[model samples]
Target: MKRILCTTALTVGALIAALGLPAGAAQADSTPRIDLRVLVVSDGGPSTDAIAAELDTAGTPYTEIDLTAADRPVIDAELLADTVDGRPRAKYQAVVLPSDNPFAANSTEMAALVAYEQTYGIPQVDAYTYARPEAGLQYPDYSGSLDGVRAEVTDAGRAGPFGYLDGSVPFEDNSPSVGESYAYLAQPAAGADFTAYVDAAVPGTSQRGSLVGEYRHDGRRELVVTFVYNQYQQQFRLLARGIVEWMTGGVHLGASRNYFAVHVDDVFAADDRWNSELNCTPGDVDCPDGAGTPDPIRMVPDDVDHAVDWQEDHDFTLDMAYNGAGSVDHREDHNGVDHLTDKLVADRSRFRWINHTYTHAFLGCEQDTTVVPWRCATETDGSVRWVGRTAVVDEIATNRAWGESVGLPLENDELVTGEHSGLKVLPQQPDDNPNLAPALTDTGIAWLASDNSRDPRQRQVGPATTVPRYPMNVFYNAGRAAEQVDEYNWIYTSRAQGGSGICEDYPETSTCLAEPLDTATGYAEYIVPLETATALGHVLSNDPKPHFIHQSNLAEDRIAYPVLNGVLDGYDALFAANTPVVNLRMKAIGTELQRRAAWQGALRDGRVTAYRVGGTVTVEAPDGVAVTATMPTGTTLAGTAFGEAYAGERSGWTPSHGAPLTLALPSSAAQATGTAEPASATDPAPATRVPEGTREYTAAH
Candidate 1:
């Protein structure tokens, strides 16, 4: 079992005695204590699971005490317990009550929980049932017959957590008698303040009552709602997140941020040869030398424009990795390149420009000095020799300059390597080009993209911070052969088809296929499902890296745009409409990671672990590094050592390096606040530089 080093409200002497530490020892090994964690009292219902999943996605620390089908004895004993691992179990700053019956008023478990809430003023969330005679528990005045009912937000609820709510929900389902019941039927006590109310057909009709309410008993506060926790419903999920944030006091954590991005690679001129073909026959006129290749595959102006328009329509931000040298065949004054850049620059709000490289320089290639074209140096190992540092700088500087000249203003210190093939160093001569670091650093490039499928060591070669991108979807390599096409289809289609041996012809016209058949060449497959799968993959893995695609995917006639649209649509259904899956650029994501990397747990001098337990976030940065904290709502700054409020959240002034920081909230605020730490006083740095040779690399768009 993993041991949790705990520091509770108990004194150090008491903790030492409990843990059998040396009596005279100065202190423990400075391993930071878990200041606080959210406690969940659940009955293992789907609703509880939904809430837990949200917390997990947010990276919130929580411990669940499963009481599913347990009697009062088991539930009461657990709640009454004072300590676990020599730390007070009651130290949980916030408690979640997903089940109405588990902690319903007057039950033995409920009594213990109520005592804890009253004493510590810990914020609690009560879903569905509250005080009720039907369940043999009664507190204030909660009374109602159990049923389904529709609700409307009251003027008061609009100012509370349910502010996003609008219209009668579950618009598809409605009760024959009650019209539409977006919520479960429940009644609020007399003292409870209603945020929402069940509406009657007429203004003063009978059936109208409280649907959502906040109850303050003595010093305890609980948000009571009648709706089930359904993650698929956007409103429910939004409300749940809002409720949690409100309870904690809107404390977004640096490490716990949900990260997202979408990078479109090879933002150059469209391939004129791209076409919708169906088959590759031996003697077919279109099949040149029987090699199944895309014909007339170039992206026309409409294709690029349509893609940009679609993304704009959805309000989706995209990262465009521009190759300054344009296509190899059309490098000298490519009108397509100019047109594409002009269009992209015109809609700067929807695109983040990235440096792909001046020429798509594969650093693995040792330039063939004798040849007029770029060529690789094939040494004895079948691998190209290392290109020197100067070559690296020229590639970066040239591309950035070109992008800026074209008004793209490519993000400085951020790059997506051409072909997603990052810098390579041969195994035999690992120490050959130590200059790659200084080269990238010199050009102000600090972030690089990598594929998750590659070996970690192979991907970690370059000096820049590596951002891992999903390697599931095809970027530009649409295979032009029978075998490659079948293999591609097998990966995505096989799951629904059971296996891929259903089609015999080059362009299999079978109904069992999951993708649409691309007639231009059977090799070109509609990868809408594949795109969706990639998005789902990143979400489940809890990796916030954006889903990546090549410029080919956006070609008007090809399968990429449709696939991308379908993927985004699926996200809307699963999450919320027009939600920014990841709104940050490559550089911003990199900086956030760096800030989080500086602190380990809540220890060290660089960054302190601030916990939002009561009113104030106790910042424990003894070696103060400008600790910033959100001021709790309904509270004002007190005259203490806590510094200025630069960006809304109270932040400490930059003191000399080793000064200690200890923030104390006003007594009233502490009594009323939840577990959310307040906002940061200092704004995040605009961009972060990887200090020389750090091996850290964040996944990019």
Candidate 2:
């Protein structure tokens, strides 16, 4: 019996040795504290820049080392990690390199990075790299332009990082002549531990090659991407989230969502129609004087009904920026009753309403239209004469009062001035009217809309904060498709092409049209796709800025619907049900921007500290600041489920309120480690075990 007992003890000791654990160890060890920051090594390339942009947009903190900089910091083991209070601590949760190997082969810097990643059990991302044996891939079977290719997310990918997608990722082919995308298609190297995440069929072949995959070798893991792309490309935007999640293990210091909102300006008002015959509007500034009668475009009762139905069908709401003075003028002209106003008022609850002032008055410096192209009016002393405060107050108050009288739901804090006036206008009024700020404060306005084309940054105007809005190219003066196409051609075509030469003079901002567009099909074919692409870019960029169009586009032929529909449909095709378009009201959008600004400032100032140890995450921030994070579904805050679930993860902003925010993660949560086990030979890799030494230290400490 003594010999048998000794044999049992000896067997147990051998088992522990095989598992790489100390004697009497019962389980794998816990990971050391890993800081929630990314390290980016850039070569000034577009692919690296694109990833950095994604990190910035999500409010994720990162330290970038430029390869071209003369005084760039060196990569070393000491820089990557150190001991904190007798415990090993990793300084970065992930590393992003310009390529798989940016340094010389077998260089100390490269060896240091590999050792750091292996020691911390952290992942590395190769932003863009070629298909070669060094990257654990066979030479390219097919290489060159990837434009118009339709790639697929593998089943393994669907179960892993790329699951947010519903399989298909179509590359854009904007112009036939330009090679917009390029990639190399290759298979995994023989006997390599590689798992393809995103792939496409090699040209003229039945076998598929990996475009994105994971390569595990020499106790380190890397996310290898074999394509060239920039920040603006649709394909890159679609895959950026997955890439970030894979690098950071879906536990990071920031969150992202797709947002879109539309504001229809000049509601209940008339817009001057473009004159195709005279090549400009018959207004005071640029047309032949008295060339034709002024014909304005206004929405009819039928148009109001169609708008409500369209909103219901699309599950979206439009913010109608109305000028109550237009209804007052119509009432006086039609014996004090107007059908369009009555229809809109009866269905007022169907849409959001913003105070657009009493009339569409230019609230900037008084205009001097005596000379062509207009200028600011001057005082007797040659000083700039400004519009007074009373005029601005009346415009805001009268519109609010009018809306209330009609039982229209309104928020007094939101305001969009006529033509975004009372603010600066280039070349004519270079400064805001001195009266605008005081008027806004008196009227209790908190959020004011500014044209992104002119003022793209949010700024203070007394008690009010500016909310920059995108101006849709759907012209305010256009009421019909043919009229819209005619004006677009007039603005974009060259003077030699019998149109304005503005595109030639300002090539940076405007691209001259190849030729005149056909008025019959141009609005539907050319203009709609171009505008839709631009708007979609904003939505995918985590931007919350609202887009503004004129009520005239919803009148007459209702030309704006096609572009709006294109944007909606295109988004649906690209994203899965887990990710929905976040449509926010003006106030809500303003608040989101405000929070982002504060959070980004906090990150920039190094006031935020976040990390994960074992099954718990901790975040610290200054008082009144909010913390944003994306974590696993089972993560909890203060004993309750945390964040709204989207794209297979939970993410939201939690107010710190001058306290530490601690999250309790479930037992199944992925834990960081000092060293991880090799991936298995399977389609989906298994979670690696934490090294035993760290766990023993954690147990002791």
In order, candidate lDDTs are: 0.48, 0.83
In candidate 2, what are the lDDT values of residues 54-158, reduced to their tens digit?
988888887777788776667776567654443345677888999999998678888888867766667899999999988989999999989999999898888
- Model 1 per-residue lDDT tens digits across residues 1-701: 00011213545465344434455532422222223445666766556656556555444445566665343224432333233223332445567777444654567667666655554456676654544433222242223322332345555554444333443432223124653223434344444443332221212345455445555544556666554544443334434554555455444232222245678777763432322243232222223443555442344456656766777776777788877676433535554345554555576555778888877665544545443223456779876566677887788898888777767755688887665543443332333345567777788777877655442322334557766666545535442333334445553344455344445333444434646344345543344454555465454333555557666556644555555566566555443222235567876665544433333232222233334333434444435333333342233434444443322233223332443333455554543333234333221111111122111111220
Report the error of model 1 at residue 80, Å. 8.5
Candidate 1 lands at a TM-score of 0.60
lDDT of 2: 0.83
- The model with the greatest TM-score is 2
